[model samples]
Target: MTEGGRRTAEPLPTEMELLADLSRLYKIQPATALWRAVEIREVLKAGLPTGRGLDLGCGDGALTGMILRYAGERPELDGLDYDHGEVRVAERRGVYRRTFCSGSEDMPLEDSSVDFVFSNSVLEHLTHLDATIAECARIIRPGGNLIATVPAPAFQTLLKAQGRTGAAREAYVTTMNARLAHKNYLDAAGWAALLSKHGFAGCSATPYFNRAQVERWEKLSAMTAGVLQKLGATNALLYRMQRLTRSDDRSAGGLLETNRGIARWSRHWARIVAGGVLDNPGTDDRYGCLLVSARKP
Candidate 1:
């Protein structure tokens, strides 16, 4: 990953291209998807006061914009990412008041300065889980919130199992071995324990999935792994299966509704078993991600 104050020769994709591709693939207007992410942030911080917030690993600042929108008034918001290219894109978009190119393993922020620290689909990519958690604890004020989401381990394991190649297998295995590597999926107990170790309290994990989305993914998975395999499209099959099984954070209803909140909570606990916990509890046949929320004490 590129560090702050450094430039690289690798040409980065234009923000417009990225947004257009994402919009086309997700079947939604780019602006609508962007605003929805903000709405989710508002729901996550429902009880907290509108104050200064930090977005850790804020890729392209989409979530940063969401945070500002959800706050109603433009509360002080800063975004940080390890990729200098992404930081540059965020700056160009004017989504964040301040965008820093820094890794989550080592955030350059003052202690107890921010009221809330939010991350989405970012903890999975860190190379230093403990250090990142410690940094979060160090930067957040007392009683401040830390909201994050990560792919569930079971989902990642399934993806690895579907990959069919020596190199692809190796890459998958490497990711699985490192807790801070790609798609670092942690169980409920593990997340709670990490929060406690880092001076956080009331740590909880909520599982999220969309019935309609999962159903569509299941169909896609069958076509890729089943039909495509017979057609001698090994690489294409793997690609489709991987894409079908990959984590989608937005599918979990974004914001919880009264009737659906209980089901989502149950699914979150189910992920504990999926993450390698011995005791198999809760009932959610297919879980893709988990949301963890805690408070600095």
Candidate 2:
């Protein structure tokens, strides 16, 4: 698969394939999440959760299903979501053996019941982040891991802020934060400290989503889901798109023509959109996301 140590002329990375796959089911979602699934997969290559895993903040179970499917790892999973409405939808996917509808600050689970808690891009949005972290600490068995991914410092300084300065820059950051429902950006150090304070041990964070990718995602987002998001139609759109996936499952032969066409275009879209910046980000001076993990102790 490699002429040299580098992957110069090999098949396109799984990330591209994943991007296309997500395009089918999550067309209305920000494309950034599709890009993130692969990076998260890469980050967790060291060790994925095993035995009694929990999908903390699992939305509709779609993203979690795609991520785990690509990772080729399927452990019995439980899901928890703040919205009872969303949890109802997630329960139908059968990805999670059990689903709980509850707030993160007060999860409904027995103490020390799960082996690992996997939260993807969820912690930063929690208003009671400390309390939620404490709950994660409490529910995870001793030595179990809390694996999460959150925005990094570069999220505030996205390449979109290239020309802005002074007050303008601050305003742009504020607007971006408000759009994302984020209170503050937390780099690897901040997350490590928080996990440690919550009695987690050997905390480590790996940064991903390089600057160029974030910029590309921003552009793709405007073309894909930006308008729906602006019109507050995201939930309704998600319902419709999710129906297509469910319908495909019940069909006899294969994916419907609609889904097939979407899949093809999505693959082509991946090719063009990722043409220049498709290289794997081995290291970066700047990145937009952090993959943080720590063991409860």
Candidate 3:
């Protein structure tokens, strides 16, 4: 239930840099920015193993692009995702040397061709963990690593603990889990044992986003998005305004860019203020997410 040891490869990004990176998400989806930006800090702290690597289950590739911006070293990066639409968006971002739209059970890569594999918050949705882990082990050279993040059991526990009973409680839990098609919610030890069965040893899981923060994210995301959508601003004026706030020249690549912006300046300001709360890196065993990594030996 412990947070993992601090990685010493390089100092983590400053609070200022975090806010700036977060600003990008804030403009896009003000409600979720707090949680997501904080997660980005964890990814930065973990620091990718240096060498050619694959970003398994890469979505729009935005997070991987952000990771590269801070990670002083550049590795040959390839990406794979089951969603072809997201694969197209990832390609436009230019974060991956190549992008493939393929299922996790079967990757379109030569066996033993990769140095490492990384994924962020993507494994829990898949039903075939064993097949996917085997595919990862098959493609990665011996001694390489598989690093990913998923909802810990505490995530579901926290959801259920929110005080409902009977069919109402079951419906709530089912609805939430259904959104992600979550097939697993294992603790670190459970994850370690699962990985060991598939030949991935030395597994470790570090918890992040304690209960208070998780609750905050859940509440704020629904509140903000719901309010905006009701007002019909999510896809109209708000969307246009968010586009204008972009500091970069690249075009916004996905449906989310047009569909998810929170137009109100108040939400943006609130996010900057919440940065402090989200960045605390609190110590709590009942965490919302777990960052898990294991070696294929």
Identify the candidate with maximal TM-score.
2
Clashing pairs in 1: 38-66, 207-268
Relative to the unseen true structure, what is the C-alpha lDDT of residue 162 in candidate 1, on a scale of 0 to 100?
50
| Model 3 lDDT tens row, 57-116 | 997687788778777566789999997656877897799999999999999999999999
Q: For candidate 3, which ten residues in a row score worst on lDDT?
A: 1-10
RMSD to the native, candidate 2? 5.4
Candidate 3 positional error at 292, Å: 0.4
Best by lDDT: 3
Winner by TM-score between candidate 3 and candidate 1: 3
Cα lDDT, model 2, residue 238: 41
Query: Going through the candidates in order, what is the number of backbone clashes in each?
Result: 2, 0, 0
Against the true structure, candidate 1 reaches a TM-score of: 0.58
What is the Å distance of residue 6 in model 2 from its true position?
22
lDDT of the candidates, in the order given: 0.56, 0.71, 0.73
TM-score for each of the candidates = 0.58, 0.81, 0.80
lDDT of 3: 0.73
- Candidate 2 local lDDT, 16-95, one digit each (tens): 66666655655335365456645655543544666898999998787787666644345789999987656877877788
* Candidate 1, 1-297: lDDT as tens digits: 221211233333322223333332223122223223322432333422347888888766754553344233455678898876567667766767788898787788898989988787778777688899999999999989898877566554444235456788766445433422364568888899888998899987766533332333333344434454456656444434333321232222223223355334433432221232112223555555576789887
